[model samples]
Target: MYKLMASLLLGTSLTCAAAAAPANAKPYEHVLLISVDGLHAVDLANYVANHPQSTMASLQKTGVFYPNAVTTNPSDSFPGLVAQVTGGTPAVTGVYYDDSFDRSYFAADSKCQGNPGIEVNFAESIDIDDTRLDAGGTPGKPMTQIDPAKLPRMLVKGECKPVFPHDFVRVNNVFEVVHQHGGRTAWSDKHPAYEWLNGPSGTGVDDLYALEQDSLIPGSKVKTTGSFKAEREFDAAHVKAVINEIKGFDSTGANKQPVPALFGLNLQAVSVGQKLPKAGPGDDAGLIGGYADANGMPNSGLAVQLDFVDHALGELVGALHDSKLDDTTLVVIASKHGQSPIDPSKFQPTDEDPYTKMPGYAFHIADDASLIWLKPEERAKALTAATEYLKDQGKALGIGQLLTSNQVALAYQDPASDTRAPDFIVTVNPGVVYTGGKKIAEHGGSNANDRNVALLLSNPSIPPRTITALVQTTQVAPTVLQALGYDPKELQAVQKEATQALPGTPF
Candidate 1:
């Protein structure tokens, strides 16, 4: 009888406190974080200004819109996504680029012996254990490269590990925070490896549907000696999974009980065939079998992808409405990175050139843009050849830009330490794109066109307004945490001083 009386008194006091609170006092109960891999802010602006049928434009009419959301440097998908979810920079998260070098390990037979493989899992690599220590061994005698066949064994033997996002991110993500607070979580995306963005253990989310089976490949599709479809059916399957989860919430009274408090979905069909249609001299067009005709013009593909994503969102929103939880749910639509132009007819591959002969060298184009790989001993010579090549290519392509080894080092130079950067970095003039001989649109570098992406927030509590703040992807995680009423002080203390709160959110 005494216990019951105490419980009743506590419930009454809680009710009184809630009633006395201000109208804007209720913290958001659910947060939805969506990442469109290559959606551009400029493209969103154009859609809002002109495309009346755009779903994004419709959301903008009801939410806080930011037209100048930029990503951190290196602007690759892994780093961009990591920043968005962690509210941290590459300096803190260590996701510098898609392809980078690890000095600890070296391949006995390969020239690029110490380079780390793509798809780094930051959290797993950075723990107290030295999972990501250079492959060759330590910082001084790191392994230069691993034999392709030995990759699995190395991972099993714990000899080599992914760097950057996999090894570098040191903290829990916003989703994890929500989960810790008793909320369920789920995420769906084209790149399953993205699960690592949160951590190696896939913390925060209880369910994940990585649409592609293997994300290490350049394109998120299975390659059967080259012939492949740009759009994988698995994308649709993931959407179905999302729908099923939402439906399950309704059937089980999960929302009223303990449904997913946070969720995310990624749609990838639009960015699938990003390459140009034709192959040029010395290009790897034949390696992937002659290119297939693009399903539609690049712009058309984007529109379709957007529409498809919208349809899925519409379904999810409908589920929320039916569940009677619309008012408490906060939905965000954002992008990891933006796309660049792709015109394959201009590609020219040359083996006679020493720069082109370097490891990982694909083609030497005329746009101050060329892909080359160099050894540590050859770094100086490669830099000279790259600068001269850029001068000549700049005049030919009408874009005066050069990316030498010095420039590459300067771009990625650790503000805290002096370390050698990528052997060769492609610096392109405005409007020039690198196909990597794939003929599809791609983004893995730092450029205004590649770094700028979209950001939208919609919820009942937020007053509709357009914001033009210089928001970075790194701000997303902290913003989400703040919206959920989590103590963001810990995250803020570790983040850069410029960390931003979500615009128009009552925190």
Candidate 2:
């Protein structure tokens, strides 16, 4: 009918336009990938539209912007990040969240004995002492700082072996493929647990710098993520490491090393701005963060963070130009996830009391999203009770939809087959955060605000064009490999999942 004809015409036009786009003559020598967590596609469009002279705006002039980039389901940091690097979902990557329960492992302190289920925590907790910036490790290397005793254990050849973050990942990542090809790679992030970026190889990143974000701010009585000021101070360390890497120096700047072919860092300031209830401890103490309206206009507090990030980006780009690598380097900006309840007024902090009261509930992780695991012996009885509770009290509990048996199987691997799969995946009403925390916004939900993030690819030779077709951030993996002149099939996950590069480009 008319709709089908219109769709065909639209497809034809898009194909012609893509065919007309210029192809790259040679691959870039370097790729700088940045993840500005909690940055929404709307935020990027709004910021650039309002600040025409901003660094993002300048990059957009030559960048291919995908305004409809969707992140992973559950939209938690770990899975979202894995998707970007491995071109796969949790079903293939086997990473559900930074904190998730796994039935295959033993407890962190269990020495591979007793119960088989363990809480897989790959966050600040793995640090020897999370309160210290060095995490009680040597001055320069953060991955070594991880406390083995804090990691989950698995029995291997009659010996108990601690599962490092890298070992938990199920698939090889972009870093692994690049490293295998002799391309130097480096990354900086907020936690030693991010060493998981090394993929299954455990030697993907030549240089990995991680400063714990939960560490105390020097001269202040606040954690790095406790306030906007502390978060900026924490991000500055990673930014410095990035600049040094761009100059062909090691993250510490004391050692001489070849410039990594792939290097990047994540920015935490904007995420804090979106979630923090107040600005900071000093003069900005009383100011609130989040947005002014549902239209995604940032408030004064969030605006301050945005401005800081834009300036930092300018510094990075300036360094690229000064190093004469701008022309040969491909710069990609993306976010792992986006925060919900942009209209701060919609935020509702609920508790897990009701769900816990269900007959067979054993454990659950309820953030903005909910994952429930029940006792296997009592699962049938528990599921019935829980279903009735949601049906009767869903409105008061801020419940939107409950995916129990068949529904969960349709979206992912069946719970009956996958022990890691939650028996119930509960998606709440928009803006309903399942926690006792004071933050106005949260991620890790099924809502659009949680999954739609900004994605941009910029190179001096690439033309500026906004791609409106819906794409997943998972495409970033193959796209990056293509930009570096490598076959995307080199990535195991890319081959397993059939992930393709983003359209509108010839790589």
Candidate 3:
């Protein structure tokens, strides 16, 4: 009888102990997401198979690589980044383009006022009266400039007052979730307009390094004459700043005392001005001269870019290793969009072509889209002519579909606001290269080639393999959440099912 009682008691204790043990004890201590804008899955595969010296190549040997990672619709930087951070689509988040018309309630015009798409600047600084704008503003005082007292009334229904990170995102981002769970967050990037994505506050990023101010030398002959060269020094400085911040966190005991749950280092060099010459060819030398001769490929300016980006990646990876955070950190390398080949012969000023003529036509090949401003009197005529021209070009050049004002408006959920859409929005097709002068690359459209980019994840927790599944940029945020053992569903804005949870992660 004594032996039987002892055996029963011991068995019960063993059962309890087993139940108390964690199912999976390994946890990711940190996450470092890097965006190498314009990187394609094919490029990554080539690098890995060829044993290239790119930092990404080194990571591919042991990391999980996705060869067909797609981005959300509109496929521009704003939407791409939002998807990556919020795990939601454009229909949910409302960041449809680099510059979207303000569709929130307006007080002055009881009727919705359609803004001119070309004139709407995402990076422009505009003054707003919170009260009037919030109240939908009074007649004659448009919502763009409203009084502060009426702010309370104009708030959008079912929407929280814009808060950083959260306001920009319709759903909660990884940082918000991590921070809510008692984790720290930080990020560094080049887009100044990112401030508005989550509103002015509550972005959840404790440390933000954005290049808001243009460092271009004003009135300098180089800039004025369009002779500016890609500045590697500027790129290096941005990287160094990120490294310094990381070091600060480690040295100040921040890493030791509740280390950051999430952090990101954005290297803009790879995507900086698609037309800019890659590093090492010499300032003022065209991109063709930089890598065309050595790579045996057409002077497309991609090789130089690849080499430049690889160097920057190496520097960043080295920094992570030096900090002793490589193994425990989950790193993601991706791009917002891919570049379009630019043929130098396609160089014709807007003034030179009757169809392309428009006011404020600034042709910076590096910009994703060509911005055209038309005089009010010429708006109608210009719109029609441009539409016809684009259609003809689409057929002739084999570029992707050209969006009419109606299509653009319908896509935005407001067809009446078609006037606010770009007079002529051309969605360039894959392999249809546009070139002017010595510039050889460009991006900005809704084409599949431009939308599909690279997404690589490397960490001990993730199994070494390749996922050929169709994944959108929005899935990135939720995947990160799952890796950290958090439920993405808890966030009101994360509508996408967290389907991409990496190997070993509990969904």
Candidate 4:
């Protein structure tokens, strides 16, 4: 009778816990995630080491800092964020680049200057509709943005209409999962194109405040906050949006709602500041050198940017405290990709288009990563010629390793049957940005430095720890779900692709 009672009690407790579920299990009721583009883990650690009183230093005091987080090998924003959010790689996610090549597409609207065809360069420019009108009414504002019809779109193979963001992604994002379970979601990002962040969800953000960070169009501003160049003030607007989300009102004094389950925004200042020329139009040449660094150190401009980001974090922290949500909210500071080579002197500019030199070749080239898409008939010839050419001029061209598409696909279990897969991925030597320009650093390679990023998960309730384990950004999805008391198995990519949560998570 005693054993029977004990078993009954145990079963009762387990039943109650299952019924209570997320309400009783989760340490955090909300998650605030933000990505800092092109930031490396070493950079953040270096900043913290040098600036003991900095904003990052304060967070580092209580946060679990991962200074050796692994990003996707491609290391571009599109694939990088997908990995972080969905825990799916290029093979499963099928997202190669933000502006990537797709042969499966038949032109819907046909952005081609000539005749429309099956090939399309799917870029961010076409993601938003024409509602984006500049201040002068010329157009290109993300505020009134919708889906555009004029841009080249990948129709549903046989369908003549274009595909939406939801259809483009192969898996569901955290937003849809959380929202489905009665959680509110909100996000603010660089371009309206980032609407893709909603992932596989036909529905867009419940509260979206997209800022045209680099809009050339005049008057194309986020009425809530206007920013120039690198979204200095736009970042402030995101902070405001988050506060508003907690309070239940968007920037537009309408649609009062409940606190969002997930809310955050990306910061562009650091990337822009790091790349900003030391001198403005009238600044002294001596001062110009102060903004840029030879070895990716935090120079004057980058330091200013770092401080600015810290200030933003402080502001957000203060707001969360003011709202009394700090204890219940988990703040994440993550990077989409790390800039390479931290030593900027390694750049080898491609003075001319290398693709043009290859005779008898029909191919499309994404010069940034040296990705070459070859026609089926010309693939063998192109591959041979390209191989010989790179071999002959390896040192001069900065070809670190040129792997065939088959190798990449085979290694990742991705078949080259997909049009999104490139014929050959050219891995340039460290710091070699093949494109000719003033850019000192570039990513989009398999270089470890390019794929190494930082992740900071901070909550006052959790003990501070620094994990040096080999954690990939893909683990972020499952980790996030697990933190929220959602079964990591619910994530399609996690379940289907077998992406595990972060190894050192407190939960």
Candidate 5:
């Protein structure tokens, strides 16, 4: 069966050149954008250096490797992923975190009444049944699986209307631009709530396969969140989807479809490998999965996960070659965020709840960092009190820098004006996770470990070189648009923020 598929792909490749002409006559016909969650830039550097025979090493010989790339502030998955696709930060995208609070929206049960400080949750909980593999939808069409009752609501002319994930975004993304300009687009992610990738128009991705990551493993009591082995299987399902799309079929492989001009998926195995501890969750063996030392060297379990991701990359590359899309396809490998506390010995988990006592505190999101929002009426006075309290208790709370609303306004919009901005942004000391979970590492902070992620742009026409100049994941949006011969200025946030394509690209 495998031999027949390869032969068929080879034949398809023979004719792909004539059939794969771009609408704008661009150099590249397709873009394979991949995000390996929790992959750090240093991790890529070490892996390539250590495994010279690996697929990443092969790409390094022809790819532009950005070693100093950083993600957005409040480096949670929602903002980090939006940065790469929209070329915007929270100020423009209006997405601080997946579970952050929004003062302009109403709670799920508000029904257009009462106060309007809604907890915006765009995670697996939005799925009709997050524990199922398909997220309570048919295999080929998962976008419809989002439960309207679980989404945030807004008063639309005296009537309460659910705000879908896509509608929550404030700007356009690369997927929207590409799809609007006569290109097929597809993406596979971990949750049905990832429909936000479709952009505000809700027409960016033609085929979106968002399988719930927390779904229960078949014949097992454990969820993928609690098992590294199940996590691999989850990743494999999405990988198989991408492979099917490579072979000119939909993600389900049951129907024929055009190969998407822009398509990719996110991998979660490496992330699970980083957070899971020795003999934790499903690991029967006592092998730990984090760094052995502070220098960022992977231990036995982490090394295995890295190997698995690399092997998956090889398979994707092989599929492209078999289908003859390798030359005309630009492969971009990046990460939404990276895990922190690489040195497990520095791990410090605290059960501190420092923000709830602050004057007029309405809500707070605390991970490695803390984002607090206060009632609007009391914000002015409460902000000052909270800053002083945080400073006075800095040592006890592991507060590194207490970014008052004034300081936060320097990078993002002023919380006084932006309904979604957090009144206080707190960066914590290294190795401090707010939750007392068994995981040794976490993200969602402004520290180096959480922000510095892997970024690589590989193509047949680009020269291989390492660019250490500081760049950002937001630059990826314009870079991808330019690669496809579209004007970067077409993106609203790119125009508003003056975002530029990544340097060192020949285009």
Candidate 6:
């Protein structure tokens, strides 16, 4: 009873004398967090300015904008999203990439044994066998570079367990923070594995919905850019889930559900659109691919995506207004990461696998550099050789700078301290797009173009203004706490790291 009383007080009113909610007590009863993957602040500014009637434009006029918001380093969706949910960097959260190697974790075959180490790819792959992490395309349409055999995977403790999205993360998220305090939560994203956002409680979202777009779907329908029509259609289920959840009903056909205190979904349409090739007949032109102009301005493909996201936002806003929840709900629109090498001429691909040729070291290469894990016996020797080899390769290998094992440990965390910390971090130049597969433009680096994403938060009470001061997505977690009336310290990561609430927010 004491806990319930506290929840009521912190969530709504300050009236201690009476249990009744004051007439103006409710400033915000619901918080909606949305992420548009691969969206840049510049894209938001550009799209809104050009598409004035769009939901984003409307948000610009009334919502607080972060013109200089940046995502966590490595700028991959996994690490980037972890920063938003956990309020910390890779050091604080133990998250660096979706497909990263862990020195302490052994392969499934060697689980719990005196296993050396293993590579772990935390994606939709962990969900089910033959999960088809890259399945799409219509019967006659072209196909993407989906090779099931090539998809990254690893068994854990000699068993195949699904790596829930939050499994690798080392801290709590807003969902768990709110749920434990008597608040309801819901979320939807690209894969069932996204169940990770639920935080450490392992049940952060009360009404969780996830879909695997990369999974194979049988039909004449093919995917567009980042996903197929069917994929976007699946994500729509998440949008509908939020609407229903707001009405006190379960999105999974259960009724009599309570309104969620926090809820949101990812709109992948923009990401897919940004990567979508101008549909055509030759040069794999029929296939959906993302390419940019020399100046990095998006062509029609990305424009379509921007409009789609805005339209989805408008629909959700309309739903809120229809339910009379608009005035009481807080709307947040942001991105998991930003797409990079925006200039068309900047995309470059290479297959410089020096580690595979060596005996004691293995590596995962992406975004023009490699994340290397050395054998326990030769850690020092391999580190030196790999660093020197890549350094010598120089622009020929498209290498930029190598963050040595010790340098990374000091900057991120010691591998001895954090097994998730890769031994070395290789960063490529801006125009360099290293690929073993199809994606032309990419992210997952410390560069500004890769990490500069769009972020905006809104409520009826907030006076809209664009903020140019540097802000980190890590600030959103604690900011969410403060906005919801919870003690910012309620978030362990926020408390330990001293993450600040977003500036200019009413809270």
lDDT: worst 10-residue window of model 1 = 11-20
Report clashes for each candidate as comma-separated counts.
Answer: 35, 0, 22, 7, 0, 10
* Full-model lDDT for every candidate: 0.50, 0.80, 0.50, 0.63, 0.83, 0.66
Give, for candidate 6, the lowest lDDT window spanning 10 residues: 137-146
lDDT of 1 by residue, 1-507 (tens): 563232211111111111111123436777778777666776567656676666666667667887767765556666677677766655455455544443233342333344522222222132222222122222111122122333211232554432323233455566666677677777775443444544643455666544332322243232311222323343555566555566553211233324567776765544442332332222335322211222112344344445566666666677667777667777887887765543334334322233453433422322123333444444445556655665665544434244455554444443113222344445454445443444444565445556667888887556778787556666677667766666554453134434555555545
Q: Pick the candidate with the highest lDDT.
A: 5
Model 3 regions lying over 4 Å from their true place: 1-26, 50-53, 103-119, 124-169, 197-201, 212-214, 217-230, 250-259, 277-305, 342-399, 402-426, 429-438, 460-463, 496-507
Which residue pairs in model 5 clash with each other? none
For all predicted structures, in order, the TM-scores are 0.67, 0.92, 0.67, 0.83, 0.93, 0.84
Task: Write the candidate numbers in order of decreasing TM-score.
Answer: 5, 2, 6, 4, 3, 1
C-alpha positional error of residue 336 in candidate 5 after TM-score superposition, expressed in Å: 0.5
Give the range of the ten consecutive residues with the poorest summed lDDT in model 3.
Answer: 11-20
Q: Give lDDT tens digits, candidate 6, residues 1-507.
A: 563332211111111221111122334788889999988888888787778888888777778999878787777878778878777777778877878877666554443356445676755555553234322321101112222333333466565443444456788888888899899888777765565676777778777666565655444234323343544555576677777776777665467777788888887866765554454211224434454564446666566556667777888888888888888888888888887667767677676454565435765657644666766656656666766766777667666777777777766788655667887777777767666655666777666567778999976667779888777787777667666667656666676667777777765
Pairs in clash, predicted candidate 2? none
Model 2 bad stretches (over 4 Å): 1-26, 352-354, 376-393
Which digits, one per residue and each the tens of the lDDT, describe model 2 over residues 5-70? 322111111111111122244378899999999999999999999999999999999989999788
* Residue-wise C-alpha lDDT for candidate 4, range 1-507, written one tens digit per residue: 563232211111111111111222676888888888767787788878888887788778878998767777577777888777787777678776665555555455454323222333333355343223221121212334644563446545454566554466788888777888888878877666666766776553566666555443344433211222234655666667666776667634356888778878788767655555453332234332122445457666566667778888888887788889888888888988876666555555664356656533334444336665655445556666765765676676677776666665664433246766766667776666655565545666667557778799988876779987656687788777777878766667776667777655566
TM-score of 5: 0.93
Off by over 4 Å in 1: 1-26, 49-54, 105-172, 200-202, 213-233, 248-257, 273-299, 342-412, 415-424, 436-440, 492-498
List the lowest-lDDT window of 10 residues for candidate 5.
11-20
Clashes of 6: 10
Off by over 4 Å in 5: 1-25, 219-221, 279-284
